[model samples]
Target: MKLDSAGLQVLSPAECVELLASTPIGRVVFTDHALPAVQPVNFVLDGTTVVMRTTPGSKLAVAARNTVVAFETDEFDPETGTGWSVTAIGYARAVTDPVETERLAHLSGAPWSPDGNDRFIVMPIRQVSGRRVRVRP
Candidate 1:
């Protein structure tokens, strides 16, 4: 297995994409008001693109538009001390086509919150990398 400098198992792009598809929630990092910000979002991977729903004109919707951002998701077991993290960096764009929006809405389902999150932001997985930590046997 490939290992990074820190001894963590280096994951391939396919592995990273698989991990990303397995998780429903992730953090999106973007620049907000000239400062870095991270927000947890409910997302689904449509192919290699990360699709997230947000209300129109929301902070994330506004700030992430046509900008490069990072999306990350991971899972860990406390007792085993084993985990894997996947991150995807790419440019984000708001889905504007009506047909595409309708298609994505079905895939996305309802928002995590009660608010109506009608806007869909799509980020194609341009660059992906991941690492896994496994406890010694």
Candidate 2:
């Protein structure tokens, strides 16, 4: 797919959701210590939110200080020369509500972290977009 001058390719919401569900890992982008940082995170897609776990006092904790964030995931088959990427722009927050946390705990697949693994971080999606790429032979 080719991006327009603004470096964006319009994609349907359903397409974005589909891409998000197909991948178990994504990159979370945020600002930390006055600089931008990105972290690889294992996440589960919960309809409109992406959930992951991170340790306390981590860069993620500092970057997601009640601020907007970007999360992205993609799948590529180099042998088949096809792939798709999806990105979600949303607000990042810690899961503090007991009810919500309890419900999210039931989601399949747990996040892996070297730090304390009990803390959960969630990104509630506000906007999503994606694009598919096909390599020319």
Candidate 3:
């Protein structure tokens, strides 16, 4: 855990995970055709692992599997100049195991896409870093 009072406050690993899980949507960054790409995902945090569903033919399905990826979510207020951002970096893997997929499916909000939200991708949180700033007075 690290802290800075003036410019930004560095959050602990636990705080980062908690903040990451509090949000319902996040952006996932991965490689697409060797070029970097970022896709928004409706995700749920399951004990520090981020889970989301994607269609079989979608680029996310093909591009994110078995790769190191970045997941991020944040909120801010323009008037206050205060907010927090947390990022999680880890290796992603498709959850082909039926039991685990079924288990994670019950965690939270329904996926934004159709196709029954069947394809599950899991990113186990390896490293989390975040910063928070105070409101301007």
Candidate 4:
């Protein structure tokens, strides 16, 4: 990673994926009413894909299907002023196959806040980028 943008280091794709796997919670950015919407979700990294649960008839279930979305996660230290941020943009779709859903079930785990989470959605990470900011001591 090389420093850029005010002491920010650009992370490699592998590094970005590693950081994503380390975190359980992330935000999904999608479209709502033709406008942008963001929602926090608990997700798991299945290889290079992101799998999460959503309820039927929910905004996520409806809006996210067959669409492009941006997922992101980050960790920051105020005192040390050091942290990393990762962003992934890709196509999202609902898991329709029962067998595939069962396979993914082993990886997704339980949702953070359950609300009839009967639907499973998957997002294939198409483009990923990350940055780390390290403040001087």
Compared with the true structure, all predictions reach lDDT values of 0.89, 0.77, 0.84, 0.86
RMSD of 2: 3.7
lDDT of 2: 0.77
lDDT of 3 at 40: 92
Weakest ten-residue segment in model 1 by summed lDDT? 109-118
Q: Which candidate order results from sorting by lDDT in descending order?
A: 1, 4, 3, 2
lDDT (10s digit) by residue, model 2, range 1-137? 55755665656888899879887789998887778889997788887888876667677765675789999898778789877788899988887665666666668454333343556688889999887756533
TM-score of each: 0.89, 0.80, 0.84, 0.86
The candidate 4 region of ten consecutive residues with least summed lDDT is 109-118
After superposition, the stretches of candidate 1 with alpha carbons farther than 4 Å from their true spots are 111-116, 134-137
Clashing residue pairs in all predictions, respectively, total 0, 0, 0, 0
Report the C-alpha lDDT of model 1 over 98-133, residue by residue, as the tens digit: 668878888888534324447889999999999997
Rank the candidate models, highest TM-score first. 1, 4, 3, 2
Model 1 Cα RMSD, 1 decimal: 3.2
In candidate 4, the residue pairs with backbone N, CA or C atoms under 3 Å apart (3 or more residues apart, or in different chains) clash, namely none
For 50-115, candidate 4 gives per-residue lDDT tens digits of 987777778888899899999999988888979989999999999887667767766676523333
Once fitted onto the true fold, the runs of candidate 3 whose alpha carbons sit more than 4 angstroms away are 1-6, 109-117, 133-137
Error (Å) of candidate 1 at residue 125 is: 0.5
Report RMSD (Å) for each prediction in the order shown: 3.2, 3.7, 3.4, 3.3
Instruction: Highest lDDT: give the candidate number.
Output: 1
lDDT pick, better of 2 and 3: 3
